[model samples]
Structures are given as C-alpha cells and as structure tokens.
Target chain A: MEFNFPPGLILVLGAIALPFLKGKIQQALIVLLPVMTLVLVWWIPNDYTLVLSFLDYQLSPVNSTPTGRLFASIFCIMTFAGGIYAMGQAKILELTAAYVYAGSAIGVTFCGDLISLFIFWEIMALGSTMVLWAAGSQSAYRASFRYLMIHLLGGVVLMAGIILHVHTTGSTDFTAMQPDNLASILILVGFLVNAGAPPLSAWIADAYPEASPSGMVFLSAFTTKTAVYALLVGFPGATILIYIGLYMVFYGIIYALLENDMRRILAYSIVNQVGFMVCAIGIGTELALNGAAAHAFAHIIYKALLLMSAGSVLMMTGKRKCTDLGGLFQSMPQTAINGIIGALAISSFPFTSGFVTKSLETAAAASQGMVAVWFLLIAASAGVFLHAGIKFPWFVFFQKDSGQRPPDPPGNMRFSMWGFSFLCIAIGLFPGPLYRLLPYPVEYQPYTASHLVTQFQLLLFAGFAFFVMLPLMKRTLTISLDFDWFYRRFLHIFAKEFTVKTSNTHIRIEHAIHQRIERFIKRLYRHHGPHGILARTWPSGGMVLWVAIMLAGILLTSALL
Target chain B: MISDQDKHWFYRSSSLPKLWMIQVFILVIALVPEFVLHHHPHFQENGVLVDATFGFTAWYGFLSCAAMVIAAKILGIFLKRKDSYYDE
Candidate 1:
C-alpha cells in the first residue's frame, strides 16, 4: 500500500508545538488542530484498511471500517469542542496534554492490532493524567496520582492479556474475540476496568471531578469511550457484559443521586451513559452494535455539552457542590439554557439525540427475546432520567435561590457548549446522517406510535418519582460510600495497622536475637580474653598442658585400636 | 432589612431575569423536538420498542423529579439541616 502522510498525525504534531507559540498563536493552534483533525477524519475515504509488518506480525493502523471511522470522527469533534471550551482558561501545559490525550485517542481508533491499540491506550492514560495534574490544585495532584495508579494497574492487566493472547492465537490482530480462552477473558476484564465497570468504577468519580474545569471536559471524553471502542472491536457478544452494564447503569444513578458536587454528578452519569453502550455491544447484533456506536457518538457530544456547562458554572462560582449553587439561572442564562438542552438530550427525551441512539440497544435485546435483559434496561433507563437527566440541572440551576449570582462564561466556553448542544439536537432531528455513518447498513427506525407513547410514560413517571422523592435527594455534605472506599479508606487503614504490627514484631525479634548474640559474645570473651586460660601470658603452660592431654589421648587411642 | 448597597446591586444586576429567560428558552427548545418535530423520520425509524423505551424514560424521569421535590419538602419538616448543619 502506498504510504501517505496521515493527516491526524500532522494535527497532533502541530498541537505539540502549540505551547511554544505565544498568546493568540497558541489559542489559534489549540482550536485549529482539533478542527483540522476532524476534517481529516471526515474526509478520509471509507473501507481503506492499511496493514504493515511488525515483528513477524501484520499491524493495521489505518483501519477505516465504518464503525472505527464514526468513533474516530466524534473523538475528533470532542477534542475540538473541548479545546474551544478550555481555550481561554486552561494553562499551556493542560492545553498541550489535552491535545496529546485527544491525539492518542484518535490513534487508538485507527489501530487494528492489539499491540498498536495498547500503545495508544497507555499514551492516553499518561496524557490524560497530565491533564488532571495540570488542574493546578493540590487535590488535583493527589487525585491524578490515584487516577494514575488505577490506569497503570489496568494497563498491566491489558498488557498481560495481550501477551497471553498473542501466545495463544499466534496473532495480535484486534478483532471480535470470543471468551473461549483465558487470555481473551483477561483482555476483556482489562478493557472493562477502563470502561468504568464496577469495583473499579470508583476511579472515574474520584479523579475526573478534581480536574480543572476544562480539563474535566477533555477528561470526560477519551478513556471510557476508548474502552467502549475496544469492546465493540473485541468481545462484542460477551453476555456477562449485559449484566455488568446494567449494574453500572444503576450504580451511576444511585451514586449520582447521592452526589452534591456538580461535576462529580456528571462524571457519574458518564459511567451511566457508557453502560448503555456496553450493554448494546453485549447484545452484539447488527442493530445493537449500531446502537452502541451511535450512543457513543451521541453520548460524547451530550456528555461534553453537560460538562462544558458545569465547567462554566464552576468557573463562575468557584464552587462544585449543588448545595453551594442555586439560582444560577438568574446570572448565567446562556449556560442554563445550554445546560438544560444537555440534560434533556441525556435523559433520552423523545426527539433528542439520545432518544434516537439508545433505543436500538434496548430493541436489540427485546428482538433477541432476552426478556430479563430488556426489563432491566428499561428500569435503568428510568434510573438515568431520575439521576442525571433531572437531578443535575435542577439542583445546579433551578433549585432554591442560593443568592450567588455569577455571570455567564467567556465566549469560547459558551461557543463550545452551544456547538455540542447544536449537534445534540441536529442528530436527534436528523439521525439519517448518523445512521448512514454506522458500521452496518441503516434499517431500524426509532419512532412509532406505541414506541413514542410508552417511552413518554416511562420518562414522565420517572420524573414524577424524582419530585416525589426530592426529600431523599436533598444535597448532602456527606459522601455516600462506594467501591473506592475499599481501596482509599479500608485498605489504607489495613496497611497502616499491618505496618505497625509488623514493626513491633520486628523490634521484639531483633531484641531477642541481639540478646542471644550478646550472651554468646560475652561467653567467648570470658573464655578467650586475657584473664582466661587460652589468652594468658602463661599461654605456653596451657599449650604444654594441651600437648600433654593430646599425647595422653593419642596413647589411649593407640591402645584401644 | 436589606442594606442599601445590596439593594442597589440587586437593582443593577442583569442576573435574575436573564437567567430566567435562558432557562425558559432552554425548556422551550428541549420541548420543540418532542412536541413539534416528534414525527421526524429519525425518531420514527430506530425501533418501535426503543422509541417506547424513551417514552417510558420521559414519564419515569418526570415522576422521579416530582417525587424528589415532594420528598425534599417533606424532609424539610424534620430533617432539613441548617446550611452549615454538617460543618464541625
């Protein structure tokens, strides 16, 4: 195959030089780079797969399957929107890291082998961690460390799985893999960890919120979505993910319901949205895969839209908790409006972007006769509406008048929010373009009389429940416990206790050993020192006596023999 | 009684009414696709069941929101803490 300079690489390479530029040049490059990448991705011809030989295996880095291209396109768009939103406020270091993080995500999208994917995956981890640290707060630094540990652990698991998989299959092509072998299952777990699957899901809420306002916007886009892309490519039909996804759906809702931090709530909702995509991937039909892909595309747009609004709020108020903020609609009108659009879209309200995308997955389950899965997904849909769709906007913008009135964000931030909000509606209103971009041919339709009516009832009833349950949903200063509690609190305490106990044991053993050594040394000195027989100036007399005894012993021995 | 400086700031601020209009506009925009463009092909074609599911989501979301508000009101009867209730 002919090698042409890949345009995506050039954009990222250009962005790396952005920090060196001053003021307007830096800002222009920050916005220009992602937009150029998006254009490159959009203009690239379809079905253009590329292969290269590496270490006796073929590496496919330019795989332009429809699914891969669609995800890549949106990731580029996210970078553009996020960069614009962050352009004014973010430090140069953060802006650079964000570009690198976005670039690596795009790189992963183009990778067609596990090795290539792994390389880009780890790049994304490190790059995003840098973004977190660039938040320029002590809490951000600590959180970035915790976040790094989690990703590093995930990277180790993924690398081990890749090694075993290459050994088992004698190939490293990243493709739809079955869980028939231990290696593939390990690979699945590794991807799931990054996907914010349970037990490890705590890392996302713990880390993302601590990031800078703009940093969180970029942070929200790449990592989990990359995992979804990986899952779509490999282990699509794994049935267990259905349940795991359902668990995450509820986990996000319940925790988000209890959360007070505005960004943290949105962070939790990211897991919830990704859970829908994971579930759809598990359903593993053409329609379901389309749903997963479409949802992911739509999710990144709306989720970023949400985070951008929240970022604006945080920027204005210097506060994150819901209780500390209210009546912000009085000050930041544009933000409030854009934020509500984001909320509506996320809730999958009829005719929104989420409405068009999320349904295909649930439909795929029903068509497959997976009754239990279908029911649970329906309930989870309600839960999504309850926690993220309503709770986020209501508390942050519309609840009691907290008497704090901050102005709207800067132009760049508003533009970012507006851009994403526009896409959310455009896609909802014109899903034909999105469906055409799917990996498979477009066939399924979202609207029907019965479909519309029932969806309305479910979401409306869920909204009703939210208001009725407002007492329970009050913003609390106390944090609800989650799986991270195991590592952050319990394990820390256990380690401290173990360290104390082991040190005490070590001291006691050292004392006993020292006493024994001292006693032995003292005995040796007593026997061998100057006052003792062997050390005396009369040692010649002792030597004679020893010789005489030796002669007596020798005579006796000779007689006995 | 409110201070004169506070009154002046409130009178001069563009926050309250502007925020209200923004929120109202957002709600209106959100409802547009639902009420006005509900029959668009994109919404009509993904799947009937999935469409139904979104419909359910709407009802479920509204009910939950309503419940939360009522519950907050009820909890205010006894459990409502001072703004600094949890502070040490």
Candidate 2:
C-alpha cells in the first residue's frame, strides 16, 4: 500500500505505443490493455490503496472505493466493447486518442485527491479532443475546438476552485458537499458544465455527431459519463442540481425532436439519457446515487449501441440525414434491430437496461415524496420513447421508403453491435449484477407488477400519440437554437460587428479630438512649444525669473479656482 | 402508397392495415396492467388523484406527448431554421 501504480496510467501510457503496433499486435494490445487494467483495478481492495506526498501535500492517486470500482468496471467494459466495435475501422490516431481518453476516465474514477482528479480530468479533455480532431473533417476539427474551449474553461474553473478549497480546508480529498461557498460553487459550476448542464448541454449534441463513424461510438462513452461520475462523488445531494438535471432532460428531448440528422438525434438522446442520471444524483440519496451510477453504466451501453448503429448506416450509405435514410430494416436487419434495442433500452421500455436503471431514479423520487419530480420523470420517460424510441427508428428504418438499401457494416462492427445488444437485454432481464456493483446495498426490485404495468402503458400510449399525431411530429430538414446560441451565433456576431463599430467610433472621435487639440497646441507653441521661447535655452537669471513667474501663475490659478 | 419496386415486405402498402391492427391491439393491451395490477403510488399521496385512476398512465403518456409536440411546434416557429443555420 505504500506505493502503487494506477491502472489507468497503464492504458493511457500504453496508448503511446499504439501507433507502433499494427494488425494483430495492435488488436491484441487494444483488447488486452483494458483486460489488464480491469485486473489491476480490482486486484487491490479498498483498504490496500496508496497515498503519495509532494510539496507538503498528500495526494491519493489510486482510490479503490466500491463506487470507484463500479465505474471503472463499466468504463473498462465499455472501452472493450467500443474497441471491438471500432476494430480495424477507426484510424490509428483516433484509436490511440480513444484509449487515452478512456483510460483517463478510469483514472478519474479511481482518483482520490482533487489534484489527481484535475490531472486526469485534463488528460480526458485532451484525449477526447484528439479523438474528435482525429475525425479529420473540417467541421469535426471546428467542433473539437469549441469542445476543447468549453472543457478547458471548465478545467481552469475547477482548478481554481480546488486550489481555494484546499487552501481553506487544508485537505484535497474529493467528497460530497453542498456548493454553499465560493470555491465549492465554482467547483460545482465546473462539474455541471462538464455534466452538459445548462447553457452548455448543447456541447454533447454539437460535438458527438461530428466524429467519424466508429469514432462517435468511442466519443459517446467516456467524457460525459465521467462527468456524471465526478458529480456523484463531489456534489451528491446538492439541490440546485435537481433543477439543472431536469432542465437538461427536457432540453435534450425537444432538441432531438427538431433534429434531422439521425446521428444527431442519437447524440441529443445522450444528453437526455445523461439527464436522467444527473437528476438522480441531485436526488442525493443512497438509492438515488446508486440509480445515477447504474444509469450511467446502462446509458453507456445503449447510447454507444445507438451511435454504433447510426455509424453503421452512415458508413454504409454515406448519408446521415434521416430524410435520406429509410427502409434500412429490409437490407440491414441486424443494424436496424440493434438500433431498436438501443432505442428501447434508452426509452426505458420494460425489460430493457434503461428500465432496470432509470426506474431506480423514479422510485427514488417517489420515495422522497417529490410528487412533481416523479410525474416529470414519468413524462420524460414517455417523451424518451416519443422522440428517440420512435422518432429515431421510424425515420431511419420504417418511414416512407427512401429506397436506400445499404448493407450492414463490417464483421467487427456487427459483432460489436451484437455484443452490446446482448448486454442491453441481459442487464434488463437480470439487473442483479449491475445492482450489486452499485455504491449502495440493494433491496430495490425493478420487476414489481405496478412498475411493469405503469411503464408499459406509458410507453405504448406514447407510441400511439407518436403515430396519431404523425404530421406534427414530421421530421424537417432543420436545426433548433440552444443556449450555445450566444457563443455560436449571437455573441459571436455581436463581438464581430458591435465591437468593430464601437472601435471605429472611438477612433473617429479620437481623431477629431486630436484635430482640436492640435489647434490649441499650435497656439501655445508660439510661446512654449519645442521651437518656442520655453524650448530655447535660457540664461540662469531668466530661468529663475521664469520659474518664479510660472509658480506665481500656478498659485494665482489655484487661488481663483 | 409508395410504389418503389425495391421496397421491403414491411414497406409494402398491403401490410399497412395489419400494422395498424397490431398497433390498435397494443394500445388495447396497455390497459391490462391497469385493470389487473394494483398501481402503487411512489409517494402514497391520495389527493393528487392521477395515480388512482386505472388507465391514468396511458392517458398521461398520450397527453404529455401531445403537449410536448404542440409545444415543440410552437417553439419551432422561432427556433427552427435550415440545417445549415449554424454553417455560417
């Protein structure tokens, strides 16, 4: 316990060697790296953890708490699943970055001190941005830049908060606390911004869609879920998060409804799904936090599955717009079916992974006697089916025939899809394994008759509403405005035109003032300018008289004023 | 009425009525849980009255979706723009 190596560092540092290995060697390394990390992560118990010293401060580098193990286990599983899916398809550069990104997420899960957390957090930002930039398209590059800016700002704010928090409390332990003080509030803002909370929730939808096909699968897994992990550890039971999480839940659905790109619809659903987890965290009970944790695990599987299915379509057809994709179920049945499982799981259809996990949050809400929250969560559950469960599949696979008969993607892609598809059903059918891994002990059962009946009625009727009101729910070739409107359009345009005009006016007025000042200066130059009498060399007697005269004149002016 | 020749079996217009029938059956079956099961309220609140009804979830699901769709359509008036809106 005196000294121990972090499991994440193995995968992250292993990424440096990724470009060197090729074909079988690279594939072996890719799969083996996570396996090795998983072994290392669990090999040490919670008691056998290490603390290091640097510059009079103690830093806990490897924290193997129950919650940390749960997150790391899921992250390692996701990385492996996503890796298998992206095998031989994604660019070597993107794979390398993804490995680093995922490893950093695992690192964050195990990090015990704010110092180690901040470092791992930054590495995640760098690694994820690299994954996006590896998309190699112009728009992907631009999106990654915007994504980096937001994360960096979040990192800086978090760093400052950590510094202030440590200075005030004389400890760097990362734990739950209300954001009552400035440092904690700043820290909360930092965490919320990353959680895709408010104003910046748009970043998930904005950046995730721009990645390369398989690249999006990896992109969807790590970053925000890691933020959910951070929030669960740092701000459990914080009241403001309830409002933030609720806002994100609805915001994601409404935006997804207006979206035309199929992948973007899935991306928006990521925000929506993550919103459920965030709300649960805000509920802040042991059951609620466990719900958040379990939901994050389930969301990773299903969201990645959805993105993988969409990515398969995009790769096969070379078109991402929903208007251009339909009747895919005929040709790419597996892909379509896989996408449907993901959709059902995401919408929390009974016996799906989401059903097992998200219901925990709803139950938590109910237990707390928060009637409105329970109602809204139920509505959001239905809305989940309405927008993602129905809209995504209907537009892509079952709508008016676009007549595009693209085949399913490569073998690895198919295998990956099947694997995640299996996990979704397996988890849904028996949530015991996931529940046992949760931070808290479990007595909650997902298969109660009341819960099952209520969930079915809610989902099916939402399906009915979707078809009955099909015209209103028609997909348009359009995008909707979000809070990023300020940075993306409004503030950008204002900074462009408004600042230019103001600067121009100031320059013009300064020039006019200079012209007027020159006249007075010219008049004075006759007496005191460089070429005037004051500029000319003077005798000692004249100098003394002039000094006396100037002093007398200055005294007279002061007296008069 | 899509006449595209390469269309799948599911896409054939002849299957429309069956699909509709299936959907209607699904809606009908949704009420079974309400009729047979004792719907437990999370908060045990007796006064709100929504949970007490047999088919309240089905109705609530439909109405909430309807409200959301209507809200989205209204908001679309101001927020929806061409897909290339952010391109510039």
Candidate 3:
C-alpha cells in the first residue's frame, strides 16, 4: 500500500507545537503522539512501500516490513511508556527530544531506502545526544559530546557505505547483503559500531549511564536497538558478526562484573544483551533471526525496567554506585521487587521473557551443530546470571545496608516500572502472541524440560557463585579499563603532551631566531657606533687629512697591484 | 562498628544459615530437572555431554564466574584505577 504521510511524522510534527501548550495538556499531547503513531503503525499494511522519484532514483521512505513493523511497534510502545515515566519530572525539551528520537528511529526502521534511512539515522543521533545533554551535569555534558562524536563517526561510515552501495548497484534498497565488497564491509562496520560491537563498544557503557533517569529510559530503547534492527534487516548471516557478537557478549560481562556504578552496570549489560541479538543474527537461521528479534523486544522491556528501578534510586537518593546503595528494599520494596523482576527477565530466568526468547538462539546454534558457538553461548548465559542477572539487583537493592532510606519514586515512575514488569512476565508466560509477530514461522518451545533444567542449573549455580564469591565481588570505587581508555584518557593525554612538547619546541626555535637576530643587530650597532671611527663625525681638518692619506694609500696600493 | 539491630530481616546475621539453606534447597530443585526430562545431547547422540550432563551448566557457570573474577583481579593489577582516573 502507498502512503502520503509517514507514520512516524506524527510525533515529529506533533512535537513542534509542544512548547505552546501548558503543563497537563502538554504532557497529554506528548503521550498521545506516540499512541497515535503506534495506532498508525498497526493500521498500515505490511511492506507499505511509499515510493518517490527524486533525481531519477526511486526512493522508498516508508517501507514497513514485518521486522520493521515489529521494531517500530516496540519503539512506539517504549516512547509511550518512557513518556509516561518522564512526565512531571523531566524537562519538556528532553521529552520533546526523546519523542523526536523515537520517531526517527521508527522512521529508520520502516524506511525502505538508504537516503531515508540515513536521514532518520542522523536524527536519532541528534535526538539522543540532546537527551544525554539534557541531563544537565558536567560529566553528562562531556559524556554527551563523546557519545555524539562516536555516533557521528558511525553515521559517516554508514553514509559512505550507503553512497557506495547505491552507486555500484544502482539501488537504494535497505535490505540484507553479502559482505563481498568494500562497500558492504564498510556498511557492516558502520552498523556494528551502533550495535555496540567491539573495539568501540565502550561508548554505550560510558555515555548511557550519564543520562538523566528519564532520559535513560529513552536512551536505552533507541540507538543501539535501531542498529540491531538495521543488522537484522541488512547484515544478517554475516559470519563476522558471529565473532563480533561473541566479543561484545564477553566484553559486557567482564566489564559489568567489574563495574561499580548501578546504572553503569546496566549500561554494560546493554552491550551484552545486544551481543546476544547480534550473535543470533549471525547464526542467520530463521529461528535464530526470530530469536534475535524477540530477544530485542524482551530486552527493551526488561532493560528499561532495570534502568527505571536504578533511575528511581538515582532520582530519589542521588547516588548510583553499588558502593553507596543497599538495603533500599527496606523502604523501596516496590522498587526492589520490580528491579528483581527486571533482573530475572534479563537473566532469562525460567518463566521470564528472556527464557522464552534467548533459548531460541542457543537452540538454533545447537541444532546446527555449531559446538563451540553453542558452548560459548551457554557459558555466556551463565555469565549473564552472574553479572547482570544477580549482581545488579543484589548490589543495588539487597546487599549490605548503606542506611539510605529513599522512598520509591513518584507515581509515573512506579506505574511505568510496574507496566514493564508485568509485560516481562506476561511475555515470558504467553510468548505465543509475541511469537506470532516474528517474520518467520514459529514452532520453538521455550519450556522443553531439558532446556528448563539446563537454564535453572546454569542460573542457580551462577547465583550460588555470586554469594560464595561475595568477598571478591565486593564493590569498589574504581573504574575498569576498557577500549574507551584509548579515547577518554590515552588519546586525550597524547594530544595534551603532543601540544605541550610542540609548543615548547616552537617557543625554543622562535627564541633562538630572536637571539640570533638580536646578536646580529648588536654587532652591527657596535661596528657602526657613533663613538667608533666609521660612525664618528670628524672635524674638517681631520677629515681632509684622513681623506688625503686614504687617497695616497689607495693610489700606492693600485700601483703595487 | 555497624550495628545489626536495625537491619532488615534479610540482612540479619541470624538469617544467614536460613538463606544458605534456601539456596541449597534451590540447588536441589535445580538437580531435579534432569531426573524427569529426557535430556537431548546438544550436538548429537555421540557428542560430548555439554548440555546433557547433570549440572554441567552449573559447574561451568561457577567455574566461569571464578575464572572471570580471578582474571578481573589480575586485570585490576594493571587496569584498575582510583575513581579519579578521569576527573576533567
């Protein structure tokens, strides 16, 4: 089917009039915008390609594939939920920016061609950066700038790839590709950058936690997940993604295991969870792809829930480190319970959202006889329980009492958390509806006795490992080194030292030149001094005598010569 | 010098053995899954017992956690820093 207005534009245009509206009405409009967009998303038919001819090329701006629709649905849902969560506390500008961000992400997801995708992609980056900067802290400001630079770099790489791709093939379709050309490889690199993939995966952990509590709800839902959607649509089955995904998985676990900040731990787990989806995408089987898609959906809910719980803690107590937070369950029982639900959901614990979803990825790997991949995935599964599943809630809400008695946050925050917590369990219990939304046929059972037994053993044992190793896993006031060191410190230091030395050398050279010029002037002044002979004014007689002598001497010298 | 008087029930030292008992009970429950489920070997009939072995995942999970912790400690020797590592 064809369309006149893009579904996501409702939010984009709706946000323009937000400033003119007052408090309660303004909040109503903000929440309504996404709800309207969500209705429009479902109302539109699948593969609703909106084609326009521009510059002799057919550009499809709105091409709603099943995967696109699925992601957009969640994005819209997230925007609605996050809007509700952010209202009353967050500045209207952040709310506006977040809606714009979610709109563009929806635009990118449903976008059919490279040009439109790039446009929406850039918007996502700008919008998210605004959300980060809206946190209004010095570190948050710095983190926002760093976050923007990395995403812009990813954007440029993606743009170059898109241009090359469209130029060579003479097509702008945003669909899957074989990594056979430099264009595709560059494109994959660009997509991987956003997917929180290796060598640069540190950006997610570094910048995401710095966002304001409400800002994080928006931040967590978009950006990386949109990239995950991009990988799903464009680069699925690329074998390299398998390794990149694996690296991100372990990288997140290891870093999170060593993390101290409450939100930062969740941030690290974002990379890790994205790693699971990327790995499933790498496996590239229909079931594996389904696994990736479902996991992303499940992940967004639980991850956002976890962040909300942590954000509530941050909002109420103004502290985020595990070293400073504990026994919040004493007063914040609801927050603790919700956070634990999020934690269990993240761990893919039995009868939670992750259980119904993440198992498909492992099942796909196992069925394929990818022995090593299967083993590593199982290990990562357990590792998830160890670091994120157990550590986040245990440290934040249930560890030794820090005597901080912050009450649960306001109604909006609690409502959203409860909503998400409900969805997490509901999806886990009744995955059939979610399963039906997948692009592929669904026949996988999440509650196979063997699978249940295996997951329970893995998770329970991981929990046991946590308590047993509690002493070693104690929180500290230290930040673990990651690849970000190269940018945040190493490159920063290198640039600082280089400028210092270069300026020093530059000053020395300039000083030396000045000294030489001074000496030359001094010597000339000495020779030509007024008191010296050549410089002296002579009397008439003396001048005539000297002239006669000089003339005679010159004449004799000439004759001799 | 922290007092235990105002601690929550979950935090009380008297509750420690009960918590451990509950954990062991959960471990026992975890063991019961293998007894009923006709477990499938992950790869093949002749394949090694990666997924099929009783509590294989448990041991792997525990060992992996231990290894990661140890590795992180070693890594901390070189990479860990005061939180003041980046202030500006």
Candidate 4:
C-alpha cells in the first residue's frame, strides 16, 4: 500500500490558502483540513510507504506504522478541535501558523527517514514560534525569540546527528538505534531537548503560556508530544531516557506547585506528562511502548482540554494568576465542569482516558520486576493528582470567591470543550478501540477490581491530602525559578554586563590613545614655537656668514678631492 | 469583605463544615474497598508483600503528596521571587 500524496500535506497546503479566504470559507477549511487529514490518516493502510529519491539517498516521505497512525490520528483531531476553538477569536496569522504547526506534527509522525523527519521537525518549530509570536504581546515576542533559539539549537544538533549517522551507516531510516555512537547520542540529546528534559526543561513553561489563550490550545498539543513519538520510535529502550524522564516528571511537579500563573502551571505539567511517556519509552517493552503511545494519545486530549479550560478562564476573566481567580464556578458553571472533567482525566481518575492509558506503563514496570521504578511512578501519579488534578481546579474555580463573575467563554469555545470532554470520558469508558490502535497486540485490562481499588485509594487520598495541606499550597504572587532563569535572567544580566564592560574598556583605550597623540603634539608644538630656536627666523647676516663658511669648506674639500 | 448574601453555598460559612465532612466521608469510603477487594500488589519484597498492607495506597498517596508539597515549600524559599522578578 502506498499514498501518492502525504496525509499531512492536506493541512499544510490548506493552511497556506487559509489566510486568503475569509469568513465562512476560512472557517470551513479550519475545520475541514484536519478532518480531511484524519480520514487520509486512516485511509492509508498500515503497510503504506512512499519512498522518494533525495540526492543520493532514498527517503521515505510517507510511511504508516501503527504508532505513526495513532499519533497522526490524534494530531489531526487536536488540530480540528483547536481550530474550532480558535476560529472565533484567534487572528488570521495565528490560525494559519497553528494549522501549519499541527500539520507538521502530523508530518513528523508519518516520516520514515531522518531527513524528512528533520524537515517536518523544523517546520513544527517555525510554525509554533509563529503561533507564539502572533499573541502580539511584548513578552510573547521575547518568549518566541527564546523559544526559537532553543528549538533551532535542537534542530542543529539533530541535523548534525542525522548527517553523521547517514555518513557512517549510510542509512537515513529513523528507526530505533542504541545510543552507543556519538551520532545516536547527539540525536537522543536533540530529542530530549524538545521533550523538555532537564537543564532546558524550563523552555516549555517559559514560552508556552505566553501564547494567546486559543494559541496555547494549539501550542499544548504538538511540540513535546512529537518529541515523545520521536523518542518512542528512534531511541526506545535507551536507559538514559529513564533517568531523564524521572527528572522531568519531578521537575514539572515541583515547579508547578510553586507556580502562580495558571497557564504556566499547565505548562509545567506538560513536561511532567511527557516525562511519563519518556520513561515508558525507556522501559522499552512492547507494553511500555504501547503505554507511551497510548498515553501520548490520551495526554493530547486531556492536556489540550485542560489548557482550553484555562484559556477560557484567561479569556473571560482577563487574568492568568491563581492569586486573582476563585469561585468562578458560581457563574461559569459549564467551564468549571469542563475544567474538572479535564482535571479528572489528567489525574487519571477512573473512567477517564488517562486512567486506562497511564496504567499500562505502571503495569509494564511491575511486570518487568522494576520495583523501584514502579514505586516512584506510583508516587509521581499521586503527585500528579496533587498539583494538576486538585490544585488547578481548586485554586482557579473552587477556592475563596474573588468576587469576579466572568461568565463562561463564547459558544465555540464551550463547544470545543464539550467535544474534548466527551473524548476524555468516551476513551476511558471504551478504550478497546483505542487499544486496538496500538502498535502491539492488546493483552491488558484497565478495569480490574484491584486496579480500580488501588487507583481510587491513591487519588482520593491525594485529594484529602490537598485540603489537609492547603496552607502549604496557597497561591502567592510569586514565580519559582527554573533552569530558564539561566537564560532569561542570569544570561541576560551577564550579557549586559559583558557589553558594558567591553564598551568601557573600549572607551578607556580610545582615551589613552588620544592622550598619547596630544602629548606628542604638545612636544612638537614646544620645539616649533616662536620662542624656540628652530621656530625663530634667522637674521640675514647670520645666515649669510653660515652659508659662506659652509661654501668655503665645500670648496676646500672639492679641491683636496 | 464578601457579604454573606452574595456568597455561594459552597463557600458560605455554614456549608463549609458539611463539605469538609462529605470529603472525609468519601475518602473513608475509598478506603473501604481495600477490605472487600483482594489485593494484587504490583511488586513485593522478600516474601513480604508491602502493597498488600492495609490502606497502603491511601497512606502512600497522602504522605507522598504531603511530602511533595513540603518539599516544594522548602525549595520555593530559595527559588521563589516576586512575579516581576523576570520583568525587572
């Protein structure tokens, strides 16, 4: 089976035409493009491949594995839902960029060669940066620059790795490779950078929230998850990912706990959720990889849903800080309910998408006898409930009334939420369809008595702990430092100081040269002054006597010669 | 100051205690499943099944959550700055 045209190109090409067409046609395409892409996503058979020649190498521009299909399916769905949500409010540039962003993410999923994957990868980075920039705020502009820099760095690293790999092995296939060689290691570093892994994990939280509310809904779905898909496909079973994933999980939880901004909290949790996927990919069993893939699918829905609710709040209330939000449930009942559903889904509460999908990873760990890993993952699950599940809804909706009565968002926004809320529960209640979509055969059940009992106990008690320790979790008008501080703050200060110091030294050097020239001029002035012998006019008699003596001496010398 | 007249029932002083009680009751009910349901520990230690202990998930969840919160607090002291810290 083969496709003459790539499925992702529908949205990419459609996005190009979006800005030109206005009103109904634009709106129709906004929704139509993704749905078309989704149909083509599934229309292609599992064995589909479209290999093309690129210079000396054969490039598989379009390939369909079960994992790629699953990811592409969700990418299309997210784009469709995000398109609907953003249509009423987002600027034309934002909508166009977001569609391209979503399209390229789908592009990455179907790519079977490293070169094509890198092409789609860079397009995603560019498109998302444009989406962020379209927010049109000063901070958004600065954040977009920072975001672009990090992604470009990651792209460079990935390209170098691909070149090296192709040069050495003469293969551009983007398949699982051990991180034993420098090329593979560089590739892993590249993927990890985008996964919001450590030392640079701060980029996700730093830039994501800067986008417009609708823009963020699109922003949340693609970038990191594409990296997760990349890791799952290209570096599965690499043990280093396990350690990196653990770091990201905890880093997200800890930072989110201290974060004051609502969207930033969600931003941090993106890193956290991707952390779980990365860890599962590291585990590398069929079930674990399935867990990673399934979790990515489930995560995109819930995370986008979560960000939508936050976006709606940000839109209606004109506020993004938890310190200024509360008791919004009184007026915005629908938004509140949707948010809680999203919260429940993200927390992996029973009968939600997260419950069925995240459990696969835990089960894999247990099955593999990784007791410590299983324990840590369980603890992190509880932590997820604490920070994202309970804290987000609690602070934003149910805490002390801020006396602000912003109604629910506009109709389209609510409709988008309803659609995703339906998916969160639908996938949970009936995971069989989703399970069958996995690359591996389904051998797991999520609704056993033991699993239900344990999950409920864990989540319920986490909820209890949330209230019991409410003081510690109180919202403050403060932001916690993350690794981004090195760039946004520390490096900023360093660069400024370096510039000032260099300019000062530059001035000092110029002044010294000027003084030396002035001194030489002064010395020359003194020697050549009217009072000096050399500067004074000689008397005519004195000059004539001197001339006569010199002439006499020259005549005597000439005669002697 | 919030007038009692405008307060929603959820936040009204009189309804707060009842809400707390309901939460605690549901939490207790969550624990009851441990007694009725047979346990399947994800892992075990040397013939001793640690997860099989009564209310282990409950305690672990609560403790781990509390620990994370406290840990965040400790770290926040050193790391926390005014929201305008970056803007400056």
Top lDDT model: 4
For A56-160, candidate 3 gives per-residue lDDT tens digits of: 788887787899889999999898899999988898788888888999989988888889888999998999999999989999999999999999999999999
Q: Give per-residue CA lDDT, model 2, range B1-88, as digits (tens).
A: 5464545667667788899999999888878666567765555553565686778889999999988888888888999889898887
Ranking by lDDT: 4, 3, 2, 1
True contacts kept of 2: 0.86
Q: Rate the local accuracy (lDDT) of all candidates.
A: 0.81, 0.88, 0.89, 0.92
What DockQ does each prediction reach against the true complex? 0.19, 0.66, 0.64, 0.81
Top TM-score hit? 4
Chain B, model 2, TM-score against the native? 0.79
Question: Going through the candidates in order, what is chain B's TM-score?
Answer: 0.43, 0.79, 0.78, 0.86
Worst 10 residues of 2 chain A by lDDT: A1-10
Against the hidden true structure, what lDDT does model 4 obtain? 0.92
**Where is model 4 chain A poorest over a 10-residue stretch in terms of lDDT?**
A1-10
Off by over 4 Å in 1: A4-8, A512-561, B1-88
Better of 2 and 4 by DockQ: 4
| lDDT tens digits by residue: candidate 1, A1-561 | 443334457455876898789988887887788788777666667767677898788887776667778888898888888878887799988988888888888888887789988888998899999999999898899889989999999999999999999998899888898877889888998899899998899899999999999999899999999899999989788888888888888778766776778898899999988888888888899889999999999999999999989999999899999989887888898999999999989988788898999998888887787766776787778777877888888898877768888999999899989888899999988899999999888688888765666566667667656665666676777555667767776898899999999999999999999999999998888889777667767658889999999999999999999
Task: Tell me the interface RMSD of model 3, in angstroms.
Answer: 1.6
- Provide the TM-score for each candidate, comma-separated: 0.83, 0.90, 0.92, 0.94
Q: CA shift at A560, candidate 1, in angstroms?
A: 48
